[model samples]
Target: MLEFKVNSQSQSVDVDPTTPLLWVLRDNLGLTGTKFGCGMAQCGACTVHMDGMPMRSCSLPVSVVAGKQITTIEGLQSKTAQAVQKAWVDLDVVQCGYCQSGQIMSAVALLESKPKPSDEDIDQAMGGNICRCATYVRIRAAIHAAAAQLSA
Candidate 1:
C-alpha cells in the first residue's frame, strides 16, 4: 500500500509501485482533470503539482510520490490558481480544451514561482507542455493576465 495526500486529502492505494501517477489519479482516485497525452512525459499533458512543483504525472511513478502532497487541477485552490483560471476564462484560452488542465497547472506553478513572469519566463516554464490546438499565444496572454490580476 502506498499513501499520499492528494488535493489535501489522504489517499491510499494498493497497486504496483511502478504504476504511473496519472493512472493512479484517474483510474484509482477518479480525478480525471489531469489528462494523459504522451505516455513518455514529453508532452506535459499530465502535469500535477507535487509539493508545489509542477511534475508530469504520466511518467511519475506513484511510489515516488508516496507521502507527498499532490495537487491536481481539480484540487487547485491557491490564489495563483484562481487567478490563472479566471484569466483563462477571461481570455478564452481554451480551444479544444483537452490540454487546458495541464496548461493551467503549469501556469499556476509558474505564477507561484514568479508572480510576474516575462514572456521568456513563461515560454521557458511552459515549453514542455504541448497544446494541439496551437493556443500558445492565448496561453501566454492568460498567464500575463493572471499575473496582473494577482498583483492587483
Candidate 2:
C-alpha cells in the first residue's frame, strides 16, 4: 500500500510501485483530468504539481509521489488558478483544448514562482508542453494577462 496526498486529501492505494501516476490517478483515484499525451515525459499533457512544482505525471512513478502533495487540474481552485483560468478564457487560449489543462496548470505554477515572467522565461518554462493547434501566441498573452490579474 502506497500513501499519498492529492488535492489536499490523503489517500492510500494498493498498486505496483513503479506504475505511472497517470494510471493511478485515472484508473484508481478516478481523477481523469490529468491526460496522457506521450507515454514518455516528452509531452507535458500529463503535467501536475507535486509539492507545488510542475511535474510530468506520465513519467512519475506512484512510489515517487508517496506521502507527497500531488495536485492535478481538479485541485487548481485557488485565486491564482482562477485568475489564470479567467485569463485563458478571456484570451481564448485553447484551440483543440486537449492540452489546455496542463498548460493552465503549468502557467499557474510559473506565475506562482515568477509573478512577471518574460518571454524567455515563459518559453523556458512552457517549452515541454505542445499544442497541436499552435496556440502558443494566445497562451503567452493569457499568462501575461493572468499575471496582471493576480497582481490586482
Candidate 3:
C-alpha cells in the first residue's frame, strides 16, 4: 500500500511499487488530464506538479512519489494556474489541444518559480514539451500574457 496526497486529497493504492504515476493517476484515480505522450519522458505531456514543482509523471514511479504532494492539471487551482489558463484562452494558445494541459502545467511552474521569465527562460523551461500542431509561438505569448496578468 502506498499513501500520497493527490490534488489535496489523501489517496492510497495497492499496486506495483514501480508503477508509473501516470497510470495511477489515470487508471486508478480517474485523473486523465495528465496525458501520456511519450512513455520515456522525452515529451512533457505527462507533466504534473509534485510538491509545487513540475515533474514528468510518465517516468516517475508511484512509490517514489509516495507521501509527496501531487497536483495534476485537473487539480490546478493556483492563481498562477488561473492566469495561465486565462492567458491561454485569451490568446487561443491551443491548436490540437492534446498537449495544452502539460504546457499549462509547465508554464505555471515556470511562472511560480520565475515571475517574469524571459524568452530564453521560457524556452529552457518548456523545451521538453512537444506539440504536434506547432503552437509554440502562441504558447510563449500566452505565458507572457499570464505574467502580465499576474503582475496586475
Candidate 4:
C-alpha cells in the first residue's frame, strides 16, 4: 500500500508499488484530467506536479511518490494557474482538447518556476508536450500572455 496526498487529500492505494502514478491517479483516484500520451515518458501528456516539480507521471512509480504532494490539473488553483487557464481559454489554445490538461499543467509549472521565461525556455520546457491539433504556437503565446497577466 502506497500512501500519498493528492490534491491536498490523503490517499491510500493498494496496488503494485511499481505501477505508474498515472494509472493510480486515473484508474484509482478517478482524476482523468491527467493524460497518457506516450507510456514511455517521451510525451508529456501525463504531466503532473510532484512536490511542485513537473513530472512525467506515466513513468513515475506510485511508490516513488509516497508521502509527497501531488497536484493535478483539477487541483490547480493559484493566481498564476488562473492566469494561464484564462490565457489558454482566451487564446483558444485547445483543438482536440486531449492534451490541453497536460499543456496547462506544464505551463503552470514553467511559469511558477521561472516567472518570466524567454521564448526559447518556453519552447524547451514545453517541447515534450504534444498537441495533435498542432497548437504549439498558440501554447507558447498563451504562456507568455499568462506570464504577463501574472506579473501585472
Candidate 5:
C-alpha cells in the first residue's frame, strides 16, 4: 500500500510503486483537476505541488511521493493561490480551459516563490507549461496581476 497526503487528505492506494502519480490521482483518487497532456514532464499539464514545489505528476512515480504533501488545484488554499486564481479570473486567462488548471498551479507556485516575478522569472517558471490555445500572453499578465494583488 502506497500512501501519500493529497490535497491535505490522508489517502492510500493499492498500486504498483511505478504507477505515475497522474493515473493514481485521476483514476484511483478521482481528482481529475490535474490533467494529463504529454506523458512526459515537458508539457506541465499535470503539474501539482509536491511539498509546495511544482512537479509534473504525469511522469513522477507514486512511490517517490509517498509521505509527501501533494497539493492539487482543488486543494490550493494559500494566499498566493487565491491571488493567482483571482487574477486568472479577472484577466480572463483561459481559452479552451484545458490547460488553465496547470497554468494556474504553475502561476501559484511562481508567485509563492517570487511574489513579484519579472517577465524573465515568469517565463522561466512557466516555460515548461504549454498552452495548446496559445494563451501565453494572458498567462503572463495574470501572473503579474497576481503579484500586484499579493503586494497590496
Candidate 6:
C-alpha cells in the first residue's frame, strides 16, 4: 500500500508504483478535475500542485509523490486560487472548459510565486499550458486581474 496526502486528506492506495498519478487521481481517488491531455506531459491539462508547485500529473509516478502534498483543482482553496478562479469567471475565460482547470492551476501557481507578473512572465510561466480555444488574451487578462485583486 502506498500512502500519500491528497487535497489535505491522507490516502492509501494499492497500485503499481509506476502508475501515472493522473490515473491514480482520476480513477482511484475520483478527482477527475485533473484532466488527461497529452500523456507525455506536453499538454498541461493534467496539472496539479505537488507541495505547492504546479506539476504535470500525467507523466508523474504515484510512488514519487508518496507522503507529499497533492492539491487538485477541487481542493484548491488558497487565497490565490480564489482570486484566480474569480478572475477566470469575471473575465469569461472559459472556452470549452476542458482545459480551464489546468489553466487555473497554472495561473494560481504563477501568481503565488510572482504576485505581480508581467506579460513576459505570464507568457513564460504559462508556455507549457496549451489552450485549444486560443483564449490566451483572456487568460492573460484574468491573471492580471487576479494579481490586482490580490494586491488590493
- For candidate 2, report its TM-score: 0.98
Over all chains combined, what TM-score does candidate 4 have? 0.98
Question: Per-residue lDDT for 109 in model 5?
Answer: 89
Which parts of model 3 are misplaced by more than 4 Å? none
Q: Per-residue lDDT of 45-138 in model 5, one digit per residue for the tens?
A: 9999999999999999999999999999999998888899898899898889988888888999888888899999999999999999998999
Q: Compared to the true structure, candidate 6 yields what TM-score?
A: 0.99
lDDT of 4 by residue, 1-152 (tens): 88999999999999999999999999999999999898998878899999998999999989999999999999999998999999999998988899888889999999999999999999999998888889999999999999999899
Tens digits of per-residue lDDT, candidate 1, 1-152, equal 99999999999999999999999999999999999899999998899999999999999999999999999999999889999999999999998998889999999999999999999999999999999999999999999999999999
Write the residue-wise lDDT of candidate 6 on 36-102 in tens digits. Answer: 9989988799999999999999999999999999999999999999999999999999989988889
**Model 1 CA deviation exceeding 4 Å by range:** none
Which residue ranges in model 4 land beyond 4 Å of their true spot?
Answer: none
- TM-score versus the correct structure, for each prediction: 0.99, 0.98, 0.99, 0.98, 0.98, 0.99
Instruction: State the TM-score for model 5.
Output: 0.98
Candidate 3 versus the native: TM-score? 0.99
Per-residue lDDT of model 3, residues 1-152, tens digit only: 99999999999999999999999999999999999998999889999999999999999999998899999999999999999999999998888899988999999999999999999999999999999999999999999999999999
* Error of model 1, residue 29, in angstroms: 0.6
Pitting candidate 3 against candidate 4, the one with the higher lDDT is 3
